[model samples]
Target: MTTYFVGFFLGLHRICDQVMAIKRGNYRKKKVSSTSWKKQLKSWSIRIVVGFFALSIFWVLCLKFINPPITYLMIKRGFQWQSEGKGFKIEKDWLPYDDLSNNLKRAALAGEDAHFMSHNGFDTDAIKQALEKNQSGKPLRGGSTISQQVAKNVFLWPGRSWLRKGLETYFTFLIEIIWSKKRILEVYLNVIEMGQGVYGAEAASHYYFNKSAKSLTKKEAALIIAILPNPRQWDARRPSNYVNSRANNIVRYLSHYEIPD
Candidate 1:
């Protein structure tokens, strides 16, 4: 009877060992599968990021040679106007860099970015001043340079978020690298909003002064640019005292604002 009990005990121990081994094997399989899935997920994530970078670069490169038929801002504005029950109109006409008025170019530089030809894509001093003013709780001001503005107007949506700012910086760097100073200014003048429904220097010149862009006088150009900060509210044809003041200041700067050859 003792011998029989010992054999039974030994058999029970063997069965327990087999069950534990099977569980260990199953755990190893699950761990391997989880690791493989994680690796695949990481690989796909990298691929998606690479694809986006490539596409963005291609988009920027194409714009260097081709004028964008429309922009993200234009679409947003159209939708916004329609939603608000306001009639929507987008007035934009593409003009070559040389065809644009010299006075308009100078006014743009003086009023928007005085150091357009010298700076890379950003103006450190302007950014510093803007930061200080915002810290002091003054009305929100922008320190965006021409290149930065072009980046936002052309490729990005308007926002003050960190993500939008980061993308703006990235596109500005690309524009400064891929395009000439003349091209940058050309694009800026062509895409910048000038009135409620008017876009670009050509349209604004026609809409406000009833003249061609190339014929825009210094004062006319300055007045148009002066109201650019709030185009929908201010009319260049009937400018307020503040607008006139800003235009006079811009005109004064134009004497010293030289466009790069």
Candidate 2:
């Protein structure tokens, strides 16, 4: 009987040793697997960074020559309207820089960004003023320069995110570097939303006044520019008293505003 007990104890000790050896082997394999996963993650991150920079350079170079057929905002609005069964279609007519009315151009500069010709991609003074106003608990006003507007309207969708703002800044810099002031204004005039479906000076003129952009009168141009702050809400054809007042102010500014030659 003592011999039988001794044999049982020896068998139990051997089983425990085998289990511990298996656990140690599994722990080593787990450590190796964790290290491999981290290496793969690092490799993928490097690839993404390289790919992003390559694509950004390509996009900037291509836009220097080609007009964008559609913008992110155009696509977003189209999808939204379609989902709501509004049958809304984007109306755009790409006119050359020469074909656009000079009055329209001046009106835009006066109403939207008076320092369009001088600023790089930002208006520092305007930004400071806007910041001060907002900090004082006043209504927030946009300090975006015409160059920034062109960048956002041409290349980006509407959003108030850090990522979107960062991308906007990058594109703004790229456009300022790659495009001349005339080209920037040309794109801005052609792509900015004028009405619900109207886009560009030519389309806005045709929709609102049944005339060509080149023939828009000074008042017509001012009225068109007046609704730009909220084109979706304000109608140039049926301007509110407030809109008319703003248009008059813009017209007054137009006398002093100079278009770049």
Candidate 3:
């Protein structure tokens, strides 16, 4: 009877060992599967990032020679106008680079980015000043260069998020490298929103001054540019005291500006 009991105990021990072995095998398989999934996800993420980089570069290169028929901001503004119960209007007329008035260019440079001719795609000093001022709890202001504005208006949506700003920086760098200074200014003048649903120099010139873009006088150009920060709020046709002061400042310093050849 004792020998029989011992044999039975040995059989139980063998069964337990087999079950343990199976559990170990399953755990190993699970570990391998998890690792494989992670690797696949990482590989796909890398491919997507590389693909976006390549595509963005190609788009920028094409715009170097080709004028964009419309921009993201234009479409966004169109929708906004429609939603506001105002009839959707997109007034933009593309003009040749040479047809753009020198006075308008000078006013833009003087009022918007004084160092436009010298900076790469950003103005470090202005950014530093803005940061310092914001830290002091002043009104929120931006140090976006004209190049950055072109990037945001042409390729991106309106926002103050970090992602949008990061993309703006990327596009700005790309345009500075791919397009000439003249081309950058041309695209900026052609795409920038001058009023609610009003885009480009030609449209703003006709709407505000009843003149063509090439015929904008010095004071007329300065007035138009003065309302640029908040064109929807300020009217160039009837400038307020503040707008008039800003326009005067821009005109006073207009001679100091040098347009890119």
Q: Output the number of the TM-score-best candidate.
A: 1
Count backbone clashes in candidate 3: 0
lDDT of 2 by residue, 43-149 (tens): 99999999987888788678777887888888777777778899868999988888899999999999999998888888999999888878966555689888888
Q: What would the TM-scores of all predictions be?
A: 0.95, 0.83, 0.94
Stronger candidate by TM-score (1 vs 2): 1
Clash totals in order: 0, 0, 0
After superposition of all CA atoms, the RMSD between model 2 and the true structure is: 3.4
Query: Which lDDT value does model 2 have at 35?
Result: 96
- Screening candidate 1 with a backbone cut-off below 3 angstroms (N, C-alpha, C), the clashing residue pairs are none
On lDDT, the stronger of 1 and 3 is 3
Q: Comparing candidate 1 with candidate 3, which one achieves the higher TM-score?
A: 1
Worst 10 residues of 3 by lDDT: 136-145
**Which TM-score value belongs to model 3?**
0.94
Each candidate: what lDDT?
Answer: 0.91, 0.88, 0.92
Candidate 2 lands at a TM-score of 0.83
Show the colliding residue pairs in model 2.
none
Cα miss at 96, model 1 (Å)? 1.1
